[model samples]
Target: MTRTVLVTGGSSGIGRAIAERFAADQAEVFITGRTPDTVERTAKELGVHGVACDAGDPGQVTALTARLDGLDVLVNAAGGLSQATSDDGSNLDALLAQWHAHLEQNLLTAVLTTASVQDRLTSGSSVISIGSIGAERRGGSYGAAKAALGAWNASLSAELAPKGVTCNVISAGFIDGTNFFHGQLSNERRRTLVEETHNKRSGTVDDIAQTAHFLASPGARHITGQTLHVNGGAFTTR
Candidate 1:
């Protein structure tokens, strides 16, 4: 049977890859983005449904959720670094703006979107969030927000598990082919990042996409409230 999956931030990067992967499995996929052009373009390119909605906005999320019925999977993939900047490019005000943007972009987006779709989720549905390795180190404001996502996922999983719903976060590392670098990653920095990975390579969008597919699969039904690290051993606890 085909499942209906909703992937936010599906216009590009990890989210787009995830949507494409699911669509390849013949799943009925719906993706959302903050912009109309990108969302529409991605949907057309990937052959998935695309909607315009900002995950950070509660009202928009509510409307987006209302449009989705019988959701089998929900992936919170919309996230990014801060766009707000200071004139000097360094200051307390800039730092504060960055923090707020990260919080809203990462944390609030997932929270609002999940809340809006909670009731619409089927019993065996899974909710996945895209996280970052920075949550473990060098993440800064974005990391803090991602850390919160893990903590929240624990509680969310506990709450949803009894109802046969699973919630988890995928902490990704050194992902390439995305705007994540913001075009600022120097060659040396890029090399250093790849060298840090046990695989000695940067991660591809398909890596995370496949993992998301596995987590949402029936075989992964027992897995919930867990943070699955897919960093090629970049930062391992053991």
Candidate 2:
């Protein structure tokens, strides 16, 4: 049977790849983005349904999930680093803005989306949130938010597991096709990132996509409340 899959931030990058993976499997996929044109274009290109919704906004999330009949999988891929502020500004205010933006984009987006769809998630449903290696190694507000996402996933998994719903976080590292670097990744930085990986290569979108597909599959029914690191052994977890 075809499954209903919802992916936020499906307009591009890892989210787009994940949506394509599901569509290739003939799943009924629904993608959302904050922009109408981007979401519509992506949905049309991928032959999936598109909705314009900001995952950071509670009301938009509520309305978005209300349109769903039910969900087999929900992928919270709607997050990223915020734009850096000018150093010319007051350090304290700039830091505060950055922190607030990071929390809203990385943490609150997933939290609000999951909360909105919690009731719609039936037994056997899977909830996957995208995390980052930054959460483990880097020191920044964005990393902190991603860390919070993992913590929240642990609790959410415990809450949903009893009802047969599984929740997990995929902590990705140095993915190639995303706007993660925001065009600031110099050749030296790129080489450094690759050298740090055991495989000596940057991660592809397919890596995360396939992992998500597996987590939502029947084989992974027993896995819940876990953060699966997919960073080419760049960061190991005990």
Candidate 3:
């Protein structure tokens, strides 16, 4: 039987790749983004349903999930680094803004979206959140939020495991493509990131996409409440 999948922030980058992976497998896929044009454009390109939504906003998340009947897979891929700024002239306020933005984008997006859609997840459903290697390193505020994501996933997995629904977090690192770096990475920085990895290479969007596909597959039914690192061994967890 065909499964239904939902991916947030699916207009481009890693999220789009995950949506495409599911669609290629004959799954009924729906994706959401904050912008109408971008979401519609991507849906047209991929032949999947797209909804305009800011997943961090409870109201938008509610409306987005209300459009779903039920889902076999839910991929919470919405997140980003906020701009560092002192635009408000208060240095402390600017710092707080950045931290709050990271928490909302990286952690709360997954939490709120999951809560909104829990009733729609059928048995054997899988909920996957996109985390970051930053959580283990010098990502600062963003890192803290991703770390909280792992903690939340642990709890969510425990709550859902008995129901045959699994929850996992894929903590990615040094991805080459996508707007993650916003085209501002220097060549030296790129080399440094790659060299930090055991594989001596940066990650691609497909790496995360394929992982999501498997986590939602029957093969991964026994795996939940875990953060599977996908950074080419950049950061190892015992």
All candidates' TM-scores? 0.96, 0.97, 0.97
Candidate numbers sorted by lDDT from highest down: 3, 2, 1
**What C-alpha lDDT do the candidate models reach, one value each?**
0.92, 0.92, 0.93
Task: Please say which candidate is ahead in lDDT: 1 or 2.
Answer: 2
Error of 2 at 211 (Å): 0.3
Can you tell me which runs of candidate 2 are displaced by over 4 Å?
Answer: 86-90
Q: For model 3, how does the per-residue alpha-carbon lDDT over 130-223 read when each residue is reduced to its tens digit?
A: 9999999987888999999999999999999998899999999999779987778999999999999998999999999999999999999999
lDDT of 2 by residue, 1-238 (tens): 8899999999999999999999999999999999999999999999999999999998899899889888999999998988867324469888788888888988899989988888889999999999999999864788889999999999999999999999999999999998987999899999998999998999999999999999999999999999999999889878
lDDT of 1 at 44: 98
TM-score comparison, 1 vs 3, better candidate: 3
TM-score of 1: 0.96
The Cα RMSD in angstroms, rounded to one decimal, for candidate 3 relative to the true structure is 1.8
lDDT of the structure predicted as candidate 2: 0.92
The clash count of every prediction, one per candidate, is 0, 0, 0
